[model samples]
Target: MALSKVFVSLMLLISLISTVSSTGVIGGKALPPKKPPVAVAPAYAPIYSPAPSPIAVPPTPAASPPVYAPVRRLIAVQGVVYGKPCSDWGHDTLMHASPLPGAEVRLVCHGKPKENPLKIMATTDKNGYFFILATKKVSEYGAQKRCRVFLQSAPTNSKFIHSTHMNGGLSGAYLRYTKPAKPLLFALYTVGPFAYEPLPSVCHQKV
Candidate 1:
């Protein structure tokens, strides 16, 4: 009617530019442009701290005191030898005590007087006894602080005479300290009845 109302307003402006170039959200349902709110950096949920438990120390008790070892001692000695027939046959300490069989005892000491004395021989058994095991390396029983018992020999058909006062004479017969000696010896001595005295029949001056 005026060219059909200007051709119906130019065909309604080309149908609204072909619905905004074929649906890039011109009319309603295409909602994708509010990008500025994306700064939501607060949701960082990584807080996990739970791992630490182990502390136990208790054990110390042995307070010092228990160490022992020391007990070693040794020594041994023994004796017997007697005879008495002539102080007139009776100085009677039991009427002339016999038993001097095969006698030959010696164990004298007093060392270093030029080193040749400390005898140590033994012989008198048949009832006369006489044992000797004393030793601290060659026995004078402890090698010399004291030692004696010397009747060196007596039995040439019995004429005997070593009664240096018969043992109570006391200048000897010492060294007597027994008990304790077994693979362990330092000193141990035992002396005797040790006596001898028969000699009063000498009549021969024939020239």
Candidate 2:
């Protein structure tokens, strides 16, 4: 009608500019070609290890304990008992070394026998000489103090006599001491001239 109403208002202004350039709006504010900003990763943040080598490690010395040797402890003893003539076997003669008064001596303390009660006998003084002084504390110094020197009984019962610890008077004679480089309150033992013989098989049993 006017040119077909001006060509129908120029096709409704080109269909509203093609519906706002296919909806990427424009003045309503959406242009659409930006997308590049999504990085976000820090919930603890702390990982960097490499620095330790100045060089130094020396610590090891612990082992030294054992040096034992100082135990010499025996206290006293001294002796002599005589009377010879069984053909003077242990010859300590001065005309058969006499001195054997009354006899009977016994200081047998082998391992503390009953706490040292060997009845403590010690006779022989007319110069037969005998001494024993130790009421407690003996044995120590290579320790094996079977302390003996027995010649118990026999100044003379004369059945042809016998005593060098007479196997019959019960074997004895082991008390020896001498250690003095410095240490003494006792310990000077000199046992024996312990003798007695006369039994040539009792003169062959009165042949």
Candidate 3:
């Protein structure tokens, strides 16, 4: 009986030693449990923004037609020339005066400042009538105040010389009236009846 009890105690001691070795325990302390492998998080895909839309533009407008101004008409200046054959011819009335045929008249006009004056010339017919067409438009020279008419020359063979009558032979004559000429395209401006007179010796010879 004593030998069997000793054999049983020895077997129990061997089993306890095997259990401690398998559990990884030593010096009467228990070992910690084994940790599981850590799981890795998946990487996120890169986010991309969409491209912007293009801007819209308006269409251009159509071109317009050109405009033009009306054209101006020409103007005609008309007048008559007279003569005093003798010095005894009175200055009061034009009855003793005769038509100075083949006489020349000049028209002078001052327009804008610093610009050259406008000059025109005309000759008298057998009736001593004269007319000059303005080279430029009437609007260019302005009103009649800007223009004057003067006697330029007379027949050299005639006994009469230039005389200051009706402000035409010596000084300048202003426009007197305006009328419409024939053909309806011309504007007639009447000026004066300029005159010429003989020298004192011619009248003395008759005396």
Q: Pick the candidate with the highest lDDT.
A: 3
Return whichever of 1 and 2 wins on TM-score: 2
Sorted by TM-score (best first), the order is 3, 2, 1
Error of 1 at 186 (Å): 6.3
lDDT of 1 by residue, 1-207 (tens): 899999999999899778866775676767465567556567787998888676676768778898776433333345666776554343535255778777777766665668776566778787877776644445433443545777677755765554545553235666655555464444556665766666544312211
What's the lDDT for residue 202 in model 2? 58
Residue 155 error, candidate 2, Å? 14
Instruction: Quantify how close model 2 is to the true structure by its C-alpha RMSD in Å.
Output: 13.2
lDDT tens digits, residues 1-207, model 2? 899999999998888778778886766876787689999986897877878876887777777788798665555666767666555644445365567776767776645436643446777777777786756545445223556667777665644256654322356666666566786766667566576666677545545
Per-residue lDDT of 87-183 in model 3, one digit per residue for the tens?
Answer: 4454644678888888889888887789888888888999999988887535423447888888888777887774656655568887654755445
Roughly what TM-score does model 1 have, to 2 decimal places?
0.26
Q: CA lDDT of each candidate?
A: 0.61, 0.63, 0.76
Cα error, residue 32 of model 3, in Å, equals 78
Task: Count backbone clashes in candidate 1.
Answer: 2
Q: Highest TM-score, which number?
A: 3
Higher-lDDT candidate of 1 and 3: 3
Q: State the lDDT at 111 in candidate 3.
A: 70
Off by over 4 Å in 3: 1-72, 87-90, 181-183
